[model samples]
Target: MEIGTLQWYPGHMVKARKMVLENLKLVDVAVELLDARIPMSSRNPEIDLILANKLRAIVLNKSDLADKSQTEKWRRFFSTEQGYPCIVLESQLGKGVNNLIAAVQELAKDILEKLAAKGRKPRPVRLMMVGIPNVGKSSLINRLAGKGSTRTGDRPGVTKGKQWIRVGKGLEMLDTPGILWPKFEDPEVGFKLAVTGAIKDEIINIEQVTLKLIHILSMKFPEALKNRYKLEVLEEDPSETLKKIGVKRGCLISGGNVDTLKTAVIVLNEFRAGKIGRFTLDELS
Candidate 1:
C-alpha cells in the first residue's frame, strides 16, 4: 500500500518452477487460483507463461471479499481475452464451487474422452492449483474436500511442499507451494499485493502500507472508508485520517494519544479479511 518496493526471493520459487515443469506432463489441466480482489496482481507471470499452452482454468478465489460486479467483469475478461474458462468462488464459503469443478471437467473433457475411447477407465483429471502467496489455495482445497485436508493459516507461505488432494471421483488437485514472482516489474503490482495482504506485512512497513491504502481509497473508494468508519472525507492529510481512525476506534494510549500504528494494523487486517466490505482493488476500466 505504501508504494511497496520490497522484493522477496524465496528459494521455493525455483523449486516450484522446476516441479511444475517436471510434472507438466502428468497434469491434464492447470487450475490457477487467483484472489478475486486483486486478480491481476495475484497472478504469477512466469507460471502463466510456463503453463500457457496447456489447458488452464482460472478459479477466482476469495470472491466474498471482492465486489460482485467487478468479479463478474474479471470472469468475463479472462474468458474472453485468455480463452480460459474462469469461475468465481469464495473458497472459504464454498460459493460458486460446483461451477469450478464443472469448469475443470469441461476443460479436460477431451482427455477424459480419449481415455474412455481407449477402453481404459477414465482416470481423474489432474489439476495444479497455483497462485501467489496467501491467495487462499489451501482454504479452497480444504473446502472442496469438505474437511481440513490442507494446512491453512492467515499468513503466507503456509504450504511449503506438494501434495495431491483428491477432490472427488474425477478430480485430483496438485497443491503446490504458494510462490511469488522474483521481481515485481510494476510498482503498482507490488502496492496492490501489499494492500490486499497477499504480501507479508513484516516484509514491508505496515504504517506506510496503511497510508498508501488510505490514499488509494480516498481517490477511488472514498465512500467505502466513509461508510465503514463513519468518518468525514477530508483532503487534510492521510496522517490526519489515520489519527481520526485511531481516536474513533479507541486505539489510544493511556495518555490520550492516538496510536496510529495500532490503528493501521486494525484497518489493514479488517480490509484484508473482508470485514471492512466487499471491495476490489483492480477495475476493468
Candidate 2:
C-alpha cells in the first residue's frame, strides 16, 4: 500500500490487449489517447509493437484539465520530433475535437490518395482508439458521435469490448476498452497512473497514492498546492501537507486524528476534477 510494488493486470485487460492486437489488422489508423496530465504514464509501450507500420495519431486527451502551455509543448514534441501527429483536446467539452478529425485524415492521406489513384471511391477511415483506462476514450467517442454512444463512467473497464461507432464525414471508430500492461515495473509509473485515475482506485491503496500525489504537488506545483489548500507555509514533507489539508477540509476522526482515507479521496477527486489547478505531471524535457 506504500507505493512498494503495484501490479494490476486484470484478466479482462489481457483479453482486451489481445483483442487490440488481433483487431489491428482491420483498422486503417491507430488513435492512441493519452492523459494530457500524464501523457507518458498513460501510454502503453506495447502499442508500438501492436501497431507496427500502422499510421497512428496521438491525442492528448483531457487537455482542458492540464496546463495549456505544457500541452502545446507536448503536441509539438510528438509532432515535430516523434513525427506522429498529435492533437490536444478536451473530449468532454468538445474542444479541439475537430482538430483531431483533421489530424486523423492527414495521417491517412497517402492511403486515401492511393485509393483515388486506383480510381476507387474513398472509403471511410477505420481507426482503433487505444489508451489506458479513464483517459477519456469513451468521452471522446461520445463527443464525436454526439450522444451517449458508449456507456461511460469515471471508473475504468466501462467499455468491455470493441465497438464500431460511425462518426460524420468519412469516419468509423472502433472504441476499445482501456487496458494496462501486465506489470508496472516502475513504481513511479504506477503511482502516476494511480494518481491520475487511469488505474482503478480499488486496485490501489488511495491513502498511499494520495501521499505520492501530494509529494509531487509539493515539488512540482507548490504554488498551486499552497493556494488551493490555503496553507501559509509549504511543508517539506508531503505527509505534513496532507495532514494540514485534512485539517483544513475537516477530514478528521472522532479523536481528532486526520481521516486519511477521506482526505485522500478528496485530494484525488479534486485533482482529477481540476479543482486544485491545471497541472502537467509529465515533463517535456
**Model 2, runs deviating above 4 Å:** 9-13, 147-163, 175-183
lDDT of 2 by residue, 180-280 (tens): 45336677788888888877788788888998888888888888899998999888888888999999999999999998789889999999999999988
lDDT of 1 by residue, 76-188 (tens): 99999878899998887888888988998899999889989999986778776667778877777677777434332232342334456677667877655334453477878
TM-score of each: 0.87, 0.88
Clashing pairs in 2: none
Best by lDDT: 2
Angstrom error at residue 162, model 1? 7.0
Task: Determine which window of 10 residues in candidate 2 has minimal summed lDDT.
Answer: 149-158
Q: What range of 10 consecutive residues in model 1 has the weakest lDDT sum?
A: 151-160
Q: Any idea what lDDT model 1 has? A: 0.78
The C-alpha RMSD of each candidate to the native structure, in angstroms, is 5.2, 5.0
lDDT of 2 at 117: 100
lDDT of 2 at 216: 81
The CA lDDT of each predicted structure is: 0.78, 0.81
